[model samples]
Target: MLDRFTMPLTHRPLASMARYLSNRQVTPDQVTLVAFLVGMSALPLLAFEYYVLALMAILLNRLGDGLDGALARLSGQQSDAGGFIDIGLDFVFYAAVVLGFALANPGQNALAAAVLLFAFIGTGTSFLAFAIAAKARNVERPNFPQKAFYYLEGLTEGTETVIALVLFCLFPHYFPWLAGLFAAGCLITAATRLWGGYWTLR
Candidate 1:
């Protein structure tokens, strides 16, 4: 939701770092893989009830996530394959974090975590499906033209998700309520995307 606004502010600094890394011959794919590893590390930390450590991992993961794209663009190595792996692994990472919460305290968090994951499916599918159709129709995404695939705007986008995850870590006991609220937002995002996609394609 806040991605568009944040992208401009973030892009310059990330690109600057990317330039330095590119000069060192670091590939965006390498950054992406490392980011995934770091992000997934939060899962174990969460399971062990290490909230502060988990928060740090989560922040680093998101930083790597943003940096990879900047590195790709700066190095002129952007490709469909890079985008594919980035998005796919991102979903996996998101799921893992939620699973971590559930594992941390299944008695309290399981149901909420499950519902959140289900909502993620809704948002992910609708977003990807719209992107595919938009591409077929030669539709442009002015707000996210650098993306390898079309970016469908949503109420629960990356920025919002990050905020929710941070909140989850800050107040582990409130995971159920936070996950539930974010899940509802995801559903709303899915519904709006679905409606917009239908009309645009028609």
Candidate 2:
């Protein structure tokens, strides 16, 4: 959902970072590993109620996430294995982040946290289903890969949700409100993706 707004800024920086890392003999797989490790560490940070540190860790992880693909393109090392690892690790990281938040404020907002987690499952499954069907159909359209590169059209994506979660962490007083908002967005995103898949696979 929010990836497109960042593209204008991230594109050049990512390209430059990829070029630099590629020249330094760094592998995209290594970058992916490092990013996943950093993201995992955020779990403990959340356990400690270190909201600021968790936010920073998540941002850093996202930075690495963005760079991996660019690094792959620059290094000419794109592979199915790399993509699988990237996507798989991403889901784990996302779930961890949400769990962290839920644990952090469990006493006061268990219901909201559970709802958010449920929405996460629904949204993730919907997006994955659409992606699988679309790929199986081999429906190639111009700039379609850009959806993976930088998701802009959907109501929500990793980037936006991370930002929203971070904001909610910063403002815990509004956590339930944010959860409700995100839930609505998730429904919209699912519907949009279903429509897209229907049209693409028809």
Which of the numbered candidates is closest to the native, going by highest TM-score? 1
What is the per-residue lDDT of model 1 for residues 76-107, given as tens digits with 9 covering 90 to 100? 99998999899999999999999999999999
Candidate 2 per-residue lDDT over residues 24-115, each given as its tens digit? 89999999999999988888887778878888888888899889988887777887688778978988888787677777778765677777
Question: Counting only residues 3 or more apart in sequence or on different chains, how many pairs clash (N, Cα, C under 3 Å) in candidate 1?
Answer: 0
- Candidate 1 residues lying further than 4 Å off, grouped into runs, are none
How well does candidate 2 score on lDDT at residue 156?
A: 87
- lDDT (Cα, 0-100) at 36 in candidate 1: 96
